[model samples]
Target: MDLEKPPAQQPPDGCLVVAIRVPVRIVMLVVVLPVRMAWDALVVAGRFLDDAVLRPVGRGLLWFGRAVFVWPFVALWRWVLVPAGRALAWLGHVLVAVPCGWLYRYVLTPIGHAIAWVGRGIAAGLAWVYARVLTPVGHGIMWLLKGLGAVLAAGGVGVAWLVRYLLVVPATWLYEWLLAPVGRALVWCVNGLVWAVRMIVTGIGTALYWTCRILFVLPALALWRWLLVPVGHALAVVGREIGAALGHAWRVAGHISRAVGRFLATLFRWIFVEPVRWAYARVLTPVGHAVRDAVLRPVGEALRAAGRATRQALASARDSARQARADFRRMLFGEPRQPRATVRREPAAADTRTLGSSTTALTKD
Candidate 1:
């Protein structure tokens, strides 16, 4: 039912539209072309001026700064300051250090050593005097005391001799002259009495000995020979046989023990001793040598170096102490002088002779 058709729209003419676009293009060219040409020319002029003038001025300023400040400072340090410092160091070594070393080594050290030697000599002389003079004097005094004791002993012997001569001789003579006859008579009576007693005692002892020999010794001897001797001989024979049997058994056991000991010794040697010896010789010895060479040797060297350093330090310290002592002694005593002694002049009387005047005149004539 809604199918009716609508009327078509009429479009504008193409020639009139093209005529309007051509006039607009002509107006734009008149307005924009001159302005674009002026902008392009200004940009080209600016680029030319920057390239020709400004860049060269900046480079000139950089080169001038380098030449005036940096190059001069480097040159002064290299040419003048470094050489002057080296020269000063060399001069100091030549003038100060070398002379000090020479003075210490040559003059100061020898003087110190000489002083030490003189002091040692003085000490030795004192010791010699003590040993030679004082020790011998003490010994001589001891010997003198012993001689005095000997004199006292000799005097005691003389006193004893005097007593014997003065008293004993008189006593003996008095006894011989007065009491000898009486003493002889009394001695004769005592001898007679002692002889009677000894004779009786001998007779009694002889009777007793004979009676015991006949009554007891003969019967005891016969019984021992017949009865006790056979019994003792039979017991001795049985003991000898048993002792021989025990001795034989002991010898057999000893032989077995010695054999077992020898076998054990042989086994120990073969199983343990030889193998241990071989291992020690081949393995342990070589390992020990390797460890010694690689580790112990280096350790020993380090220790030796440390010891040398310590020894040098100790030597320096000792030298310092000695110098200090020497300085102190010098301050106290000013200077030491060598010991001197003067010999006394002997008396002149032994050099002169006295002569009789007449004899001298006769000899001169």
Candidate 2:
């Protein structure tokens, strides 16, 4: 099935909007158009200046800065600082790391092991004393505590019975029979007094509330509703119109600026860029190609051939020097003997063990 697209929605507009919009937009446009055009002109001037002058100048300055300031530091880091850092690291390893490692291995490790052995011996002695002497003593003391607890528990039960009869029973009876009725009567009298006082306070508070509302609050509410609200709404409407007009004018000015820029760009391309491009393609390219083929290619090949010959000669000389050094070394110290190779032998059949047979020396038959 084919589906039709929905129509675009339009914003709701009233008579106030229609009356205010046109004049506000006209005023905003008059104010903004000149500014937008000047902004567009400045933008074009800045871009042209960057491309023709500032960019090339910046690049040349960058190259000069690198030669004067950056390259020397780079060379120093590569050639001098790197070697010094490596030498310092080797010295640290020898003077500090090696000595610390040697002390840890020989002196500290032996002392720690001796202290640990002594600690273990002390721990064993404490464990033996705890098990042999303290354990028996603790058992005997626990037996005496059990007997004393039994005697104390019996006396506590007797004292509890005496306290219940002598104090608790009489106190409970006195509260139930004598004090409860008097307390109830007092509570009833207090409730009556509280009710009377609450009624009098309620009447006074209600009268005060209504008096305040009529005198102060009602007038303030009337001022807000009848006077301030309408004035505020009028100011709000003016502000809204102004903001909407500025936004609409800015967008229209942007469109005009974009169109002007495009026209200027097209004119510049036709008047300047096309001729330069044509000259480069039709004239410079062929001349450059002819020069490269006739002059540069042969010189490059000759230079490469000379470099290869020089490299081969240097390699031959280096090989001859190495061979002479080896011969002199052999004359001074005799030829080195190669190491002899050893053979690995497997067990004989008589020595081989099966799963059912014992292979261990202690268990073998």
Candidate 3:
């Protein structure tokens, strides 16, 4: 199975892009080479400065800052602030926390309980009054209001009957007999007038719309279609080509700069790094190996031998001292007694059982 993906095909470039690309690349090369070189130079100088000067200075500054600022603050926090904080915590626990806890437990709690009991008693009294006294009073008042409402409702019905016959019935008859036909005729005439006015207004509006279209909108549309669109399209094409050319030029300039950088690096290696490497490999390595063999190795071997002899002497002295201490103890307290081994009650090896023999009472052999 072929797991590799096929390469994507790029679209073909237009003649405008092709024509602009070379000149833009040339110009970009001229412009970018100096800038790239200056940037590389600054980078090299920065690295060299950091390695040779800045690192040591920064380390010194760090030590100074630690000594002057950090260490003092750390010591103050450790020795002074921590102790002060502990003392303040103890004081607060004794003076504020203990007192507050006592007040809450012994004073406030009992007071709150008493207040709650009193409030409950007052609430109970109020509830008793409401249930016993106010409830019956409210019920009686509501009954009386209901009876009054019934009587007032009967009177309202009588007044409603009188109003219907004296005012409402006459007004209804007048409206039906006298006013209805006149209102209907007036409504018909008004509807006709409104329709005629609407038709006139609609015609006027349609004429105005057509006039506006001819005077303003059509010419503006024609100008946009015939003149502005083509000009805009051309400008867009030119802008696109310029932008593409700039991008292509920038990429080409980058490639050229990279090649220049590599060439310079190679040149530097040839001029400086190669000779140093050669000197270290061809000249210094043999000299260093000779010096090690002639001077360092023998000195190291002599030092090791001396160290072994000293260790042997120290061991023998330590053994002697230990033996003397043991003799001194023997002189003072006599020799230590040796431990005795216990005797075994089993039979000797000749009486032992073999694989073909049995020693049991039932199968003795």
Candidate 4:
């Protein structure tokens, strides 16, 4: 079954026909012709008045203005204003900057030097006072404090000695008389308790070890010697052979699995992945390209045409406005010239692609 899209709409044949309004336009021109002629005649009269009377009078007034006002003003600016400004500048510099510089150099410099010298003298006096008077007084006070500290330390030693001689002697005597015997009894009791605990722990460990040797270890040794040795030796030889066979089988299975996995991987890559890639690259990519050619390109062209039409309309309106303004000016001032042509500008192109590099990259991949 065909799943293609339907055909696009077709324009009607009669859309291109142009209707003429020759009779109405002729009637309108006939009706308004006298009024337009009158307006044009009035405009011509205004132009003649401006050119013949107004222009000559304006020229006389311009000459009068230049002679009566402009030349004298120019002369004052050149002679009086310029010279006065220069004199003012010179006077200001000589009165302000020169005096200030001289004062700063002669008066302020000496004052600053005198102040600095006084400050140096004061600093020297302070240094002398610190070295001669304050130093001796500070040393005498420190010596007194040291002597007082030494006396206090000696008193503390005497007090400590008296305390030891009194309290410590009694404490030692009491410990020797009463606590020493009690401590020796506790020591003896602790030693006896430790000996009893050691003997009990040792006896329990020896008994448990001997019991295990008799019940479990002896039976295990006998079973190993009489029964387990011969049976285990035979089993070992059999197990070795079976293990070798199983190992060989396991190696074969591993190789088979690896080969099968590789085959499956290769099959999937070819059957599924390659087909999908080819479909994307040849089918979907071309479909996208067709969409660009059929839909986007036409749309872009249509939009460009519409934009050009709109710009032409706006330019026409602007030209009409400029001409109207010029005509109005000419009617008022009696002059008219052809209007300048407006510059036409092209618009920037718009992007119409819905899918970008992402589609191409996916198709390639």
Which model scores highest in lDDT?
2
Query: Per-residue lDDT of 1-365 in model 2, one digit per residue for the tens?
Result: 75988888978877887798899999999899888988989998999999999999999999999999999999999999999999999999999999999999999999999999999999999999999999999999999999999999999999999999999999999999989989999999999999999999998998998998999889999999999999898778778899999988888998998898899889999999998899899999999999999999999999999999999999999999999999999999989788997753544577775656566456669
lDDT per residue as tens, model 1, 234-293: 666555544554554445544555566578779999999999999999999999999999
* Candidate 2 clashes between residue pairs 3 or more apart in a chain or in different chains: none
In candidate 4, which residue ranges exceed 4 Å CA deviation? 1-141, 224-229, 243-365
- Candidate 2 local Cα displacement, residue 39, angstroms: 2.5
Q: Top model by TM-score, which number? A: 3
Candidate 2 global TM-score: 0.57
* Each model's Cα RMSD: 62.4, 16.7, 9.2, 41.2
Task: Judge candidate 1 at residue 44 and give its lDDT.
Answer: 56
Off by over 4 Å in 2: 1-5, 8-12, 49-73, 178-237, 251-365
Name the better of 1 and 2 by TM-score.
2
Ranking 1 against 3 by TM-score, winner: 3
- Per-residue error at 130 for model 4, in Å? 11
lDDT of every predicted structure (CA atoms): 0.81, 0.92, 0.89, 0.81
Candidate order by lDDT, decreasing, is 2, 3, 4, 1
> For model 3, how does the per-residue alpha-carbon lDDT over 1-365 read when each residue is reduced to its tens digit?
99999899989978976786677667766776677667766877899999999999999999999999999999999999999999999999999999999999999999999999999999999999999999999999999999999999999999999999999999999999999999999999999999999999999999999999999999999999999999998678667766766666566666776788789989999999999999999999999999999999999999999999999999999999999999999999999998998775654688875655565455765
